[model samples]
Target: MSEPEAKRIKMADGTKAPVIGTHNGHFHADEALAVYLLRLLPQYANSSLIRTRDAEVLKTCDIVCDVGGVHDHDAKRYDHHQREFNAVFPGSATKLSSAGLVWMHYGKDIIASVTGLATSDANNDLLYNKLYADFIEAFDANDNGIPIYDPAALRSAGIEKRFSDKGFSMAGVVNRFNYAATEPRNAAKASVSADAPAAPKQKTQEEEDTRFQKASHFVGEQFVAELLDKAGSWLPAREVVKQAFADRAQYDAQGRIIVIPWKPEGVPWMEHLYNLEEENGAKGAVLYALFAESGEPDSKWRIRAVSLEPGSFENRKGLPEAWRGVRDEELSKVSGIPGAIFVHASGFIGGNASFDGALQMAKQSVDM
Candidate 1:
């Protein structure tokens, strides 16, 4: 289907399509993302976009964003420009831009639309919170000019960045779509005498609108990609780790050893394991995770030591000291376990040829 037709709803009364309004001229990432996010819903997917600063023109819009000077969800006006506006997403101190405000209201519905999950589903809530923390919060902070790091702390520690990373974010990409701020001055200098004042040459509404659409699509596609990754890959791994943590007793009475049937590449289990431990009211409980090595020709299994904290290199418990840096027949003889492959010098991980041998290694470690 053609793009315009896909975005137009058939009106029974023959009225014009619902209009989503924002200010015209140079655009920023916040309103661009806000418009794209609104378009994801069934009601607004077919809506028309109108960019203007005229109050009368804005009043004609069904929903206005980033220029209305007011935020009223019931009135469908989301703007963060007012003097008293200090609105933020619940539990977050970073100020909301029009993007965060729209997300604060319609984010769950957007997630449900994209992932085919009910808004009330626990998994939907999980994705909603996770996406905001991982993806959306950055837009909010960037648009509001909030720095991610403490400047004073960096100075106090005498820390300096080794490389420049400016303009490397999605927000930076969106900013590049804006009409050049220097174009007007350059045009006036070339076409008119310097002695006389010259009005700046401005892009027509249609030209600016085209750039806005491009910017919106760019940010929107990125948002969807992040959402899909969380739903398709991350959530499944969360379930796997949750179930394994719950079923840990079957592998050992201490409930310190969990078994994973298999591990998928780029799918994490440690973060989930730590969260599950806290949820189960037993922090730092699990010490080891056993899993079959995925797609290996020799049917190898591995036992990994769980860190004392998430993202920490320090393990809660390591494998036997005697087995560290040992391999093959020597490892088998040292550990008295069959089919042993090897153990890292750090003892954070070890390998075996069978699930039984892996489980036996974990149980022996638990005993030690």
Candidate 2:
């Protein structure tokens, strides 16, 4: 028997074609942009952008979209920006979702400085696309830098009905709300709370020292914990390096104790992809860091400092000469200590709000 032919539907106008809205290539285009940026900067370990979320792309795309300025076509450069230094992001001070945050504390000129990629002839659309493409190099979800559109967070803030009423899809307007609305006041208090003590126009040097000491100790702990959590099977070593920093008495004279765990053999940790294997036969993956750092997988990396093995050296090239990864490079640039930290007033971690806490709490002054 012959099979029935397919039934085709046509537009009301009888144009004999499908009626479909234009697929907003915004999200897909954003993803493409992100992937492009990540692919270019393979030199920086932090450039390992990994998130594929639509909302993230939208948010990042939004930021890059707004960037533009004067350019000198003759020089073939956008402008003289401290591109090298900004490329070396000294840890961010603003919350990630606060797209306006960059403009609030940082200037648009700064974006041009590091990007050196976005040009004067380029408009917002082109600049945004270029920035998005550059961003995908390392989109760590856990990093506050990664734009996390939590629908639940929106729901908590009465955003579900708001979004529904506005006729915008969750994907379109997800990153446009204030998640932590109560933080600005809290940060103010931390800076100028004088209810119980003698008031001063500015925080005394002693207060400054106290803040750094506590925050750095907290940072070191968090780093080690994060590493162990990422390491799959390795545990932090019970032994810690016993030494005190000469600057202040933040830690003990014997030293701030740091523990190193046993690192496994032949594991894959190239470009934020950590594949661990036990000496015995244990096999499985562990945590996925929002933003984990890694060197070139193809290039042999010297273990400059392991979470458990401090001051340890390894020869990635094989014998005699030993070279190690610089674990503290980024953090040291931001805070004096290679791995120092700043905690938020609220105890929670891994959110942009908490990152602002770092900015407010860090004893160091904001240079930019």
lDDT of 1 by residue, 130-161 (tens): 88888888988998889899888999999999
Clashing pairs in 1: none
RMSD of each: 5.4, 26.2
lDDT tens readout by residue for model 2, 195-250: 55424355443443333223323332332343233222221110111111121123
**Which residue segments of model 1 deviate by more than 4 Å?**
1-13, 179-202, 263-267, 295-298
| Model 1 TM-score, 2 decimals | 0.86
Name the candidate that leads on lDDT: 1
